[model samples]
Target: MRRNDCFFVSTNIFSTGFCSLRKIVRWMLVASMLTSMPVLAGKTLDGIKARGVISCGVSTGLAGFSAMDSKGEWHGLDVDICKALAAATLGDARKVKWVPLGSQQRFPALQSGEIDVLSHNTTWTLSRDASFGIHFTSIVYHDGQGFMVAKKTGISAVHQLSHADICVQSGTTSEKTLNDYFRAQKMKFRPVVFENFEASLKAFFSGRCQAYTTDASSLAAILQRETRNPGDYLVLAEVISKEPMSPAVRRGDDEWFAIVKWVVNALIVAEEEQLTQANLDTQKEHGNAVVQGLLGNADDIGKLLGLDRAWAYRAIQAVGNYGDIFERNLGSGSPLKLSRGANRLWTHGGLIYAPPIR
Candidate 1:
C-alpha cells in the first residue's frame, strides 16, 4: 500500500491492522458526544400518566384568567392553557384536575408537587425565577400593574393617588410594585393588604381603600364580573409595572418542562399558521409542510418531547389556537372585551411569538 493510502476495514476487525489517525480521532469524538448527551427520565410525566390526569394550579377566582362559573365549570384563558396541555399529553383536554390556589399558595403548591403545572396568571421576575426552585415555561400574557378606583374617587391618573389608601392582595407582586411606584415618585401611600383576592376586591369596592391595585387585565375582569355596575369603576390609564404572566413548573424535570413549553408554543404557531379548531382537519389535509408537520402528517415532532405523533393536533382540536383562547376568554367574545393589544401575534404588530415547530 502507498504511504498516502487510507486503511479499509473488512468484516473482520483484525483485517484492518493499520487505520488512519484522523479516522480514529473522529470515532473517539463521536463516542464522547454520544456519552455526553443528557437522558430524559420524565418522572413527572410518568406520574401524570399514572394518575390519568394533570394537576393544574390556577387562581382562586380571577375572571377572564381563571374562574368557575355558576355551573361549576372552569373557564378562562389560564384554564384553556391547562386544557391544551392535557390534550397534548393525554389526548383529552378535560383530563385536568384544577386546583384553585391563592397568590401565596401558588408557588408552595408547585414546589410541593401538589400540582404538576402552575397555569395561574403569575408574573415572571428574575428574583422569583432564580430563587423559587421552579422554572417559568413561557409568557402567555403580556400585562401591566395598574390601579382601579371607583369612578367617583376622582382619581383618573396613577400619580393622583398620592397618600391614598391602596387595597392589594398580599404575597403578590402587585403589593411590591405599588410601593415601588409610590416611593419612586417621592410620594406616600397606605397599603391595605388582604390575604384573599375577593377580600381585596371587596375592600376596594366597599370604600375601605381609595384604589385597588393588581394586573390591569385582572382589574378589567373585576370591573366586568365582580362589580355590580361595570361603569361604577374605572381602570386608570397609567400602567406602573410590566407583568409578563407565564406558566411554571418545578425544576429538575427537563422533559416535563419542555412538554409544557412546546405545548404553549404550538398554540402560538397554530395561530400564526391561521389554523383553528374549525379548520384544523381541513388544513391538515391540504396545508403546507409546516402545517403538516404540526398536525403530525409530515414530521414526527411529537416524539422529540416523548409524545405521540398527534399531540399538537389534539391540543388545537380541543381549545383552538392561542388567538381563539384569548378572544373567547379575554377579548370580545367574553365580557372583558379587551383588545388584543400587546398580546397579539408578532406578525400582527404585537409581542406574542413562538419558535418554529419543525
Candidate 2:
C-alpha cells in the first residue's frame, strides 16, 4: 500500500485491497463542480440585475404587436410582455431597453447574448425549439394564418383565389404555411415574396398582388395602419395554420425561464381574480386569500425566483392583466380592433389558461 499527501489509504471490503477514500471524495467533488458549471458561468438573472435593465428584442414595427409610435415610443402587445418581464425581474416595468429586431436578426441576437429576452411574436415550432439552443416559455398569443383581400375583389373564401398573386414575407412560417395550404387545396398561385413586411405591404397596396397573407392579427394591423380605407379590405373567415406565438429565452437558464413564464401566468391569473392596477392597493388590504397569494400578499412566491414579493404585482400594475393588455393594444380601443376570440380567459370559453399560483 502506498500513501501520499493528497491520497489516503483505506480498506475496501468489496475488493480485498487498499482504497483511497480521499481520491473518491476528490472525484465526487469534481463531478459536483462540473455539474454546476452552467449555473456559475451563466446566471441570466444576475446579469440582468447587474445591467439594471432588460434588453428586450422586439419586431421592427408590426403596428399592433410591437411598433414605434410617432414620438418613437414602443407600444403594443409584445412590448407589454417586455415591460411585464422587466417589472418581474427589476421591480420596475420601465427598466427595459427595447431592441428593434428584424426577422433575420432576432434569433442571432438572442443566441449571441445581445438581448435578455425575445418578446417578439415568434412562433413556437418543434424545429425552432429542438434545433435552436433557445427555450420558449409560454404561448402569449394564439394566432393563425389568414388572407386579406380588397372588398371589390369579391373573393369571399380562401379556395376562391385560383391563379392569383399573393404578397408574403420571404422568411416566415406564414410563407411556408401558405405554400402548404395552397398545395393541399390544389390551387395555383404566384407568391410575390418580399424581404420584409414593409415591402410586402407596399407591394400588396400597389396592386402587385391580389392578396396579402400572414398571421390574422398582423393582417388587421397592416390594414389599420397602412391602408387608405380599411373598410375596403376584408380579412377572410378562414384561419389556415396554427401559430402559437410565445416569448423565448436562451437555453440552460431555468431560473430566467421560470420567471418569464410565471409572469405571464400571473397576468392571466390577475385577470381571473379581477385584480386591476387601480384596485391593487385596495385589493391587497381586503382581497380574497387566493388573490392575496397571487399578488404576493400572503406568500413569498417572488422570493422563489430571486425577486421581491411584489414582483407579480408590479408587472400587473405596469401592463394590466392579459385581457386588459390585449384590449388596449390589439382589441376594440386600439386601431386593430381585434376581438378576444382565442385569447380570452379559460373561464370565458377560450384557450387562455394559467396554472395556479400555488
The global C-alpha lDDT for each of the candidates, from Candidate 1 onward, is 0.90, 0.88
Q: What are the per-residue Cα lDDT tens digits for candidate 2 across 1-358?
A: 3565224433234344324666788899998775544344348889889889999999998877899988989999899999998988897888999999988889988877778889899999999998888899999999999999988889999999899999999778998999999999999999998996678888888788889999999988888778889899899999999999999998888888899999999999999999898999899878999788888889798888778998988999999999899998999879889999999899999999999998
Model 1 TM-score, 2 decimals: 0.87
Worst 10 residues of 2 by lDDT: 5-14
- Stretches of candidate 2 exceeding 4 Å from the true structure: 1-42
TM per prediction: 0.87, 0.87
Cα error, residue 133 of model 2, in Å, equals 1.0
| Cα-based lDDT at residue 197, candidate 2 | 67
lDDT of 2: 0.88
For model 1, state the Cα shift of residue 71 in Å.
1.8
